[model samples]
Each structure stands twice: as structure tokens, then as C-alpha cells.
Target: MKCILFVFGIIALLLCATVQAVDKSACSQPHEIGPCRKADPKFFYNSEKKACEDFLYGGCKGNDNRFDTKEECEKTCL
Candidate 1:
């Protein structure tokens, strides 16, 4: 009984870690500017600085790290 409980606890902890990792995966993406000539301003979470920073984004394909506002980035990443 005690061993079973311990195994269950370990499994729960691993699941929590995996969920958290998935949730934060977008925040872990590097800032991408894409291959365009647009100067649209955007915000992204800087993992190194642990804060949202602004950057000019192209009007094409980019990663999920882009956000329209710093508040939105903070809400998602922080």
C-alpha cells in the first residue's frame, strides 16, 4: 500500500512537470523576425532576462513567441 502510494506520487509529480513544460513551451521559443520587410512592432518573452521585450516583426511567418502587447506576453509567460 505504501509503495503504491509512493509510485502514484512520483507519477503525479512527473505529470505536473510535463504539463508545466508544455504550457511554457511557447515562451521558450526564440524571437523570430521572419523573412519580410515589415516593421510591425511586437513583444516577446525573453527567457534570459525573464521579461517581455519589444521587437519589430515581419508581416509573415513567425513563431508563437510574438505577442501584440507586453501585458499579454507577461500573462502568458510570466
Candidate 2:
């Protein structure tokens, strides 16, 4: 019973991990907008379109445009 419960818990955790909540306006920096691609300018992830249409409409700006990695982008952009 304990082993089965442990396995189930692990599976549940993995399933939860797989579920990613898309952020429409994840980027908050004014300068760093270039790097981060607009959430869904043309393509819509799943069924819901990105909330921040402006972000997508305008090209990446400032630091966002410069960094490659998310962390780097955040640091530079945000």
C-alpha cells in the first residue's frame, strides 16, 4: 500500500509539472522587449490567445531583445 501510494504521488507530481501555465504578459521591462517573443501574435497556444497583445505586436525591445536565456532576458529586460 505504501509503495503504491508513493508511486501514485510521484506520477501526480510529474503530471502537474508537465502542465505549464502560459503567461501572456510575462515580460514587464520597458527596455527589454526585443528578446522575448510576443506571446501569441499570430499563433494561439492551446485555445486562449495571449493576454498582452501589445507585447506581441511590438517587437522585442531593450534588454529583452539582447539576452538569449530567460534569466538573462529577465535581468536585462526587467
Candidate 3:
């Protein structure tokens, strides 16, 4: 009975480990940038210009000036 319990515990630990290994995500990598970019990044608030304007997004990396829409940018900065 003790041996059976030990086997079951080992199996459970392996199952948990396998599930965790399979669940390892690629979001942290630069290649997977879909989740990093805002859903709508048409405009960003430019602190220098003191207005919301359009700019290019390389997808993964950006500055604090980024915003999803013009209104969202204006709401905070303006």
C-alpha cells in the first residue's frame, strides 16, 4: 500500500511537471510581438509636440509615449 501511494505521488508530480513544461509561453521572446503591441496603435502622444500624432511601431519595443488611440493619448497628456 505504501509503495502504491509513493508511485501515485510520483506520477502526480510528473503530470504536474509535464503540464507546466507544456505551458511554457513564448510571449517573453521578441519574435512573439503580437501580444506586446497595443490592439490599436494608430496614434501616440508626443510629449515634445504636446499633441497626439502618428508614428511607426516596430511591434515589440516602444517608449512610454505610446497610446492605443488619439483620444487615449490626449486624455492623459492633454
Q: Name the top TM-score candidate.
A: 1
TM-score of 1: 0.70
Number of clashing pairs, model 3?
Answer: 0
Ranking the candidates on TM-score from highest down gives: 1, 3, 2
RMSD of each: 4.7, 10.8, 12.7
Q: List the residue pairs that clash in candidate 2.
A: 31-62, 32-63, 32-64, 33-60, 33-61, 34-60, 34-61, 34-65, 35-64, 35-65
* Position 36, candidate 1: lDDT: 94
Residue range 1-78, candidate 3, lDDT tens digits: 999999999999999888655433211212212335454435665545666776556566544555566676565556
lDDT of 2 by residue, 1-78 (tens): 999999999999887655422132334423233455554332112113212222242344443222234454333223
What lDDT does model 1 reach? 0.92
Better of 2 and 3 by TM-score: 3
Clashes of 2: 10
Model 2 is weakest, by summed lDDT over 10 consecutive residues, at 43-52
Question: After superposition, which runs of candidate 3 have C-alpha atoms over 4 Å from their true positions?
Answer: 1-41
* Model 1 stretches astray by more than 4 angstroms: 1-23
lDDT (C-alpha, whole model) for all candidates = 0.92, 0.39, 0.55
TM-score for model 2? 0.29
